[model samples]
Target: MSDTKILTLIEAVTAALDHEMGLDKEIVLMGEDVGKNGGVFRATDGLQQKYGDERVMDTPLAEAMIAGLSVGMAAQGMKPVPEIQFMGFVFPAFNQIATAAARMRNRTRGRLTMPITFRMPYGGGIHAPEHHSESTEALFAHIPGLRVLIPSNPTRAYGLLLASLRSPDPILFLEPKRVYRMVKHEVEMNGVALPLDKCFVDREGDDITLISWGAMMHETLLAADQLAKDGVSVEVIDVATVAPMDMETIFTSVRKTGRCVVVQEAPRAGGLGSEIAAEIAEHELMSLIAPIGRVAGYDTIMPYAKMEMQYMPSVERVVEEAQKVLKYV
Candidate 1:
């Protein structure tokens, strides 16, 4: 029998959680509709039945309480994985996440470490309501002592979530719900965890480099395929761990290509794309063949269902931006 099974990104998440919870009894899950309801996206299906109420818990519809309780539990030596349901709903838990959970280890002089994984479904494209489709990952990425992580595919989702569960610090595990079931990968059940703070180069090319994460990675890859057909060799990178970004890999890619384009589903202003562009401009400007390009969402509130697609960065937009960058000089 094959050890590796085909699983979607969200299924990989469940597999990771189940594997870790079995190995470590100290790990517990808490969130709204996460237990019996299996999470709004069914990411936690059958976990409650397997681990029972204590390990896989369904909490009140209170984001603050969930985060606060996770912080306390983690401080007491328990690995608590709390779900915020949606990224837009996490603001209420900011006090606990930013002020407490993030600072626990440093404040306690390494005596108390918070092994907490705060999970949330983020990004647009699911036709969700007003507060359900925001992709404000930069908010938590700006917080000190917090590791921001986003997985682009099933394989990385499994490995990265396992790594997050085993971490000694607080992590914001942002799941791009848009791609939760967009694709699948054959993943082995071995408890192997991918390294944190590294960029995964999905494709290698010399003409230009494309950097993206989460759901945007899907579009980026698609755009790369399209660009390739037009004779443009595009290097595609998945910025899985956004915070404490692995700029070295990106710099190396940009240095080789001498041109770069960043794609993001979040707003253009104050976005992580801006940070990547700025970093490249600062360190790799001498290697440039053209100005850095960015394809991202607008700086306005994410519109509801019908207009959600319009607000997102499409494959065409990414290609257009890359072409514009390629056209320069």
Candidate 2:
């Protein structure tokens, strides 16, 4: 039997970080409880023991300080992978991220590179606390200098993280908290990195295009399966990198399908789906048979526990919107 064990997406995150830290002595891991406690989700488990306090050091609970410190360290010639416990808590760090880290390379006139990777778990449906669940990736996507990359599975979690670490610029790495341990897949520890700003076609079809990312990819795939049985022929595309989007891949798929349905766990207003919808309308307008459909979360704040189900876009919801788009055609 192969030595590869079935690993969840969270496990893949730990393994990938461990692999990178081993190779790059300059890569420093810092965050709240990330050292001794191994982070809130234990994604940094055992890394502190292996790399010691010098490399895998823990930080205070201040998000702004964490972001500023990481950017400062990166400016002084260090690759810092700083973790913000949850996406909701990332607000305090936004100023540093948008102003310092993202603007570093351009600000320095290409004299320096901010090889900083900001890690945070995002999205809802895990029944977590208010500050722990939020899908605000679009806020970073709209920023010019920063890059936002989201992983939908264990393999991409491993490969894309490696790529983000190797990047010359800053990267916002958002993990879908709901699916952190939802599915397991065999991912090799070969240290190979996947390309950023690229889309992965999870399923191929000829009738309609279904675009999504993060945990929502699971529901999107499920909807595609049901639509497939009904002869809808849904093509599923995972927007791996939210920023610097690989629109070419989507346009090609949309051209073939003639219809598109975008699903996002975040609110519909100013969400990444809206951006994709705009691009489709501009470039593939002639090819599209119907107006693009968006299945997304509500605009209100992500409510407490049980209400999460209603806030998140479900498989049924995606299917309903997809059906509507096809019917319009």
Candidate 3:
């Protein structure tokens, strides 16, 4: 066990990678500016100095090549954690991810596995340019073999990333860029890995189940507090594993609360929220007292600067929606 100290989300990420790389020689970190620069966000800061260039590698600005190289390394028994800079930039690597990395296991009938962790900073709250900010977790989650995990805080980010590296299949580790340094918490440097495909109960309440992941989890929790002050009991669940979701956890909560409000930074159509809503409708329909409410981004492209705030689902929006759901008899 290691002594716990308060650290930012990015610091926790760096510590996890450093700890993992120290323990596993086969584990390698590669990306556009990951080497001497310590990644674009410095999440890999000080790693290159400790692990050296071979383990903490810097690659050309080729997104496809980065992922393709990772696939080959993974197939060859190397654990490659490749960062894609931004979710929007992940487009060039779609073929490698959707076609190669995702299908390798099934294509070979489980003989070989791609133990690769594709890390990317995602979501739009920093007013970054068009390609710097995108919340397309749903697009990647739709892929069959790729497991998607988003962490709301430093501790989970550390544990989940460690787990992703240990898994035999490919993983899309989308770090909520918006909350990277929003707050700090005491995180131990222990190398323990958290379980994947699970929903974590962030706050326990009985009035309603508030479900969300990634950067939206911050907003969801913020709204949960407001609802709490109003005498509404809200149970907040962070759907950390976006796909292969631990629906048992979600269904159980909805069954207890009889009402649900799902929030997402992504657009409404075809987002994970819709999938959750469908499940609630199918399995938990009888338990629901009100029609489920969804708080999500609009169908339009995320705008620039100040307008970005308008594009995302605000705290008020989540509160209002939760209140509406509570009103239904």
Candidate 2 residues 85-127, lDDT tens each? 9999999999999999899899889887799999999988888
Candidate 1 TM-score, C-alpha based: 0.98
Clashing pairs in 2: none
Count of backbone clashes for each model? 0, 0, 0
Candidate lDDT scores, in order, read 0.94, 0.93, 0.92
Model 3: lDDT to the true structure: 0.92
Native-referenced Cα lDDT, model 2? 0.93
The number of the candidate with the highest lDDT is 1
lDDT of 1 by residue, 27-68 (tens): 999999999999999989999999999999999889999999
Report the Cα lDDT for residue 121, model 1.
93
Model 3 TM: 0.99
- TM-score per candidate: 0.98, 0.98, 0.99
Point out where model 1 deviates above 4 Å. none
Give candidate 2 regions above 4 Å deviation. 1-3
Better of 1 and 3 by lDDT: 1
TM-score, model 2 to reference:
0.98
